[model samples]
Target: MLKKIYPLVFFISLYSYAQTSVNFTDNFSGIESVLYNPANIADSFYKVDINILSSSTTTGNTYSTVKPLTILKDNKFGLNDLDVFKKISSLDATIDTIFKISKLKDLDSYVSKKEFSEDSNFYGNSTILGPSFLWTVNNYNTVGFTTAIRFNGYAYNFNSELYNQFTEKTYLNNPKKLLDNNFGNLTGYGQAFAWYEVGFTYAGVPIHTPTEFFKVGVSLKFLRGIKTYSFLLNDFTSNFSLNEDVPEDSVLDFNGSVSVSSSDTGANYGQGLDIGIVYEKRNKTLPINNIDKHGNIYYSKAPYSFKISASITDIGFISFNNIKTQTNNVDLNLANSNFAISDYLSIGSNKNQKETYLLPTTGHLNFDYNLNNHWYLNTNLDVYLFSKDRINAMKTVSNISFTPRYESQHISAFLPLSINNFGIYKAGFGIKTGLFYAGSSSVLTNLTNLSKEGDFFIGLKIPIYNSKVVSEYKKGIRKYSLLKIIENIDEEENTDSEL
Candidate 1:
């Protein structure tokens, strides 16, 4: 039976290696998951906006091989255990079936036996920085520009002992021998991903008034991305039982450990598009006929007006090259004659042979109402439609996020209202609901355990100006007359004579 299984195990291992190479699409969409829309650049004033978001979920199971595989029976005839056999058989069948059903047997022919057991726990955290600017080109037109950078990093551990114990013949069905193999130890894997984009937008107001205006805008963006992966496997010293069949409780201990690391990097480039609209209305007065103070009809100023806008960003996509590497520590007894140390020390294959897909574009909506000179309210909603790359990477899992905000501004002092005035000041307090994504939290979830799902923001806005103020004295001096000039000259002559 052992000899019969050896050939099957060899083929299984080879097939696993071919399929286990990390797919670039799996890591490329992390940043694209956060963009709501590209048009946000057109609606923003020349101000910097920074938002921090986080979320997490207990939906996925932890990595554990011991719990999933248990001994049902043990015998002297090669130590029989039905449960472990079933589990290993199921894994092998699943991989083979996928290849056969997909007609990918020829494609998977290149896989090696070691690649078949590349199981590791997957997890990570991400951050995004977005900055935008809008400049008015004329009374009826404006141009906007924005740039965003997204970074993602993750750490994972592979259960190498479990894998080796199940595949190697020497450790079959003996808990003591399995323990001697150091099967539960952890091996680390990690990757860093960065995505950046720069966009340009043009907006114009077809209709404008003292109190209201309507504007529309569109933008084009350039995108660039980079990714790096690192794999580390710790070495170990093993103890073996002289007996072919060992008891479940027999003691076996580890004497030492070893470690090896490998890394690889890849890069790609692409482009996208954005569009948006803005509406603004200010204070207005209504006509009224009535008797007021001192028997005169008086009118009062109207309440402050409202502003609303929406935009869609990253409405496009890009393609890039893929790079991959692997490293591991294998027992000298189990290492195949064909295995080279260099293969376990560095990236050996699949370089410049693959292409990865990026995440989909995003959309955003914003609204604000000014109640009066001293108080105001503001809010925003953002949506991320999962991209094709994300769906493919996650095996077709769908993901989305929604974010909202509210704010209030107060003015402690007021400047006199006049034409061409230059100085203004204001301060405010703001509270925003925590970010919420469909089926999970935002990419920031790993950094914060914020169960409440919201954040509080506080900020200030101030304006300073340089301008000419027309006063009564300056106006009168400008209206110089001949008689005034002669009077000033006579007064000077009298003063000189007296001196």
Candidate 2:
């Protein structure tokens, strides 16, 4: 059933632009570790953080100019020119009737009559809203967990115009001919994706020295995505009426119309893993200045600490259920014989078909250093690896996102600070480059493009305790009550013994 509707679905997919930037702020998979180190979370019980990002880009145009009907015509006729008899074979009678008035003598006429005036000056903007929570176990051994939800949405619109011009004499000779089909309107292509993940990490192994730490974490995620496309056509007319060659009564004039709509909802599921390690020299001796009141030398020592850690994140796959639908009219004769459109323009046929595919899995690597608890800096690199078909199948139509699955990478460095005892703040900058693997795969091939780089992120973190905090507080209360009871009993015993 899906095979019958694949072509229509494929056409819709072609119009969608699914490529998005993977900058420092856009790294949802790394949020847990970046906001709360395992040791910190374990000591504090848990941490909560939220990050928001906005980015924009103007890209160059890169679409081939070929009329839809021309391609179909060539495939059907197997003819190089209109002069060949085979060129008209199997053409629908309605289309053939319109073709009879044309002065188009060859394939070149049809090709040249339409201009490929597509420009790449494409503009896109995106915003990401993310919130996460990380929990810790205890001081000696810390178990941390985090759940982050990220929302990413963006839109791309194009200014495309199609015009046809023919000699006035040709219009006079064939009054039924179309001289101009100039039509232009806004074409909408937008995407929205929501990523929700819950992850847990265990750090500060009891067996490790006081200064050394290691952690491992895993995340299970639920991904929901919604994409919409709006395509409008306008300003279509026949040249015969404009030429005034045919009698008013004999002229057949046609007005242009357009169809605008949205596609189906997209949803998926994904999972990932993250692991980290931190080693610190908590007891370092520094040569101290020797000073005496009268210039005599007395040596004193100072303490120093240094720490380093690394982590990997977002290492899993997202599976997609092919919940595809079309908002425009489907030509039953071309694909499915049973396809029919109701009065409301709803597809009443083949409603039970569903397709399934996989979205690309993305990953990241991070390294950080803490200098004496007052200052810290970290660097992160991320990559997206997938095939072309895998990406295309998941995209909405009218999207011009040309990101193909190859291998794209990004890097950033930031400085984080502890605010009092309850909060932490960080600000940093980064860059992204390469277009190895980006977006859905069906539209393009193994293609590579110039890399793009961008800025860093600014974020804050606060503690949010898990069950451990309540448990610890309860334990303290119980101990205090027990101590009071023992005291009372001792007092009673003393009085009785004294009596």
Candidate 3:
């Protein structure tokens, strides 16, 4: 039943990283912050930001901690030519001897083998940002555009008994008493999809006062779905008998109903929306020159001591117009004999159908506190808006993270500590220097092979800071802010003493 599942797993292994960025709270992040909260674009440090290219991937499962990057690294650096299976097969001589009797490979000994726990689920996603840019229009308004390709896949509610049937040969290959005589009431769903989006964002400061500021932003996107594969097992029951002498000769009774769909033709279209709002506690010590909302001016520095933000993203769905779909209902008795499960399952008609699938929408809340001019602390919570049982919707994991960071005009570094819905804790670090950035959410875990998930991402971009700040300072329209003035005063005093 899961013969085609291997490819999905392999595909997921190739792109395993995490979703959110630790530097989203940085004032200089610019357009990259649009993915988390568009409101952040307002009052940002950059007058113009252009993303050349960026890619990230997320990995999670109740299975192994083998990251795709780790695998690639091993293959590139390790000297042994033996494949993964060969290495595992050579682990235990006794187990290999026992498996020799059954004429089957021992997969249970694989280091990254899947485990059957009370909660069995897997989720993976990848994103590639392609040629995007942001521009500050005026003092109060900012606009940006983005293009990205995304992929998501998930499996939920997988049962252990059914999982064993696929992994253990004794369950079906050898002569043995039926484990349950009749195993029934099994349900699960798995889905994978890829799509691309082009989006436009607008952000503006709605209310700016002496001690308070409010900003709002929205992004509207057009989505083109490339392909999709989905399967749902509503109910299943099976009873079987195995011939002791001939494992290949088995009689089985099957009763189940499943819905399966795969894309076949042209691209499908959809629309998506992301909305966010931010409120700031203005720093009274910072020097500010109030200007009309229509003025072409920008802040030279971050002006808030504390800020809180909320956002909801990916609120949309895509329709697969050209698809091959089948909903099979099987109930066979002694009438089912030597036919393999796959051969018998194809006894139904497949029709071309249209199916609309929802995106992995999520909500985020963030609180950021500035410790000083160059240091800050941020806390964030992310939650999925849709239920896991909604098989038509892509799935995303929820997590809460706290990060401490150092930020400056040209460089920033952050350390994030987070825990996901699965109770997996992670510590990660990220750095942005000039126009290049790279990080991993599960860096510690990936290094030790102790985590069930891992992540890695890198990006390059060009950022142009506001020239108006320099012009204003030179023309006497502006002076150094409070902190800068104090630093200059201290420097001059030290210079006089040296003289």
Candidate 4:
């Protein structure tokens, strides 16, 4: 059973620096841009944006695009599939060659030899929804609200000792070297949850003169842990018989602080907020005036400026009550009530209970330089605040990127060159026609046979631009109300008579 499972479950923890939607980082026109940095709301071009439906997916795993196991078998089956359980477990030389990339290499004794690499992670399978809203009420103010359902999984710290035992069917190596002190800490947790966010933002006349401006924005989010399953391991120790030919008193022995479960029976709740600020230098070479809905004109202060922004996001946690957590309790849950493993050892018995999960906190910094009228250059940086040591954390591996874009009031295109969180170079592209924008963060993984990781984001919305606010009334029309219009007409006649 373990041998069969090693093939499927191992791939789950293979992604590092998961969220790589670089194109969305500097796309100020799209509502999704706020997800990258709340401060971006200050740069919004539209007065009102209503995102009807939007979605995005990001995924990664350790396996290369060419999967040997998938090619070797005609019918593919997952580890949990009933059909796969029916087959006999087997490992061949060819199979080993294909998966050799994940094998542990030489490392200092201070570090666990179980690690295939410093960054072996997995994340994704994400979806978002709702009619997210944004409003640029005036030249100095902009606000937005976004709602989304995030479902994802993440795992890390697969030590070499555990890796060899699961993948090996030939001769067992020394169990003491594989386990004992060598068993390093492996921690992972996954959840499928929904969050409703309401954001209020304000951006006014800037820091210095009209040529330079500053603004700040914040987002408040409420989280509901709809369904969740998590597993955690710390200071694990194991011992087993090296000789498979002879059956010993105990073939396998293990004890450690571990938590594993399928799902929780109770409800979960959480609250979090994001804060950001932006500064821009306006070109101010030409005066820009925009018409309001009421036939009035307002000045455009954000026209053709070099924008710089910085913000920290997702600084919050979720508390789950009565969660199905593995407790270090008295009773042991296993087959045959007559037998119990915890009776012999002092450890390994845990019950299901409540747990608090933390959100993935990130730091963002961006720079957007307008080159002439339509061409703009953008540089963005994202860094994960929490390292692997943090529990249930989804920090993005830090990366810096530069994107060149051609943007107009209604249409835009961008080509970005970036080094991903994992330090892999990515060449991606994006395009926007009217109120729709779509693109990938890393096109190499999707276009070629390298299935390491990829990110795609798409959104739809009806946006009200500042430049397009047109009124139905004629010039200088008193459209406030019927009485007000009549009073204004009478005042105009009186003023004409006095003149």
Best by TM-score: 3
Q: Point out the worst 10-residue segment of candidate 3 by lDDT.
A: 102-111
RMSD values for the candidates in order, in angstroms, are 22.9, 22.4, 7.6, 12.5
lDDT of each: 0.36, 0.33, 0.72, 0.56
Please state the error at residue 301 of candidate 3 in Å: 2.9
State candidate 3's TM-score. Answer: 0.79
Model 1 agreement with the true structure over 401-436: per-residue lDDT tens digits: 222222211112111111100011111121221121
Runs in model 1 lying further than 4 Å from the true structure:
1-133, 146-148, 152-192, 209-212, 228-267, 281-304, 325-348, 387-499
Total clashing pairs for each candidate: 24, 29, 3, 11
TM-score of 1: 0.40
lDDT for 164 (candidate 3): 54
Which lDDT tens digits does candidate 4 get at residues 356-466?
767778888888897755578988887878875676564445668888988755678888777756545666788777768788767654454444556667778887765
Give the TM-score comparing model 2 with the true structure, all chains together.
0.37
The TM-scores of all predictions, comma-separated, are 0.40, 0.37, 0.79, 0.69
Please rank every candidate by TM-score, starting with the best.
3, 4, 1, 2
- Candidate 1 has its poorest 10 consecutive residues by lDDT at 19-28
Query: Worst ten-residue run, lDDT, model 2?
Result: 417-426
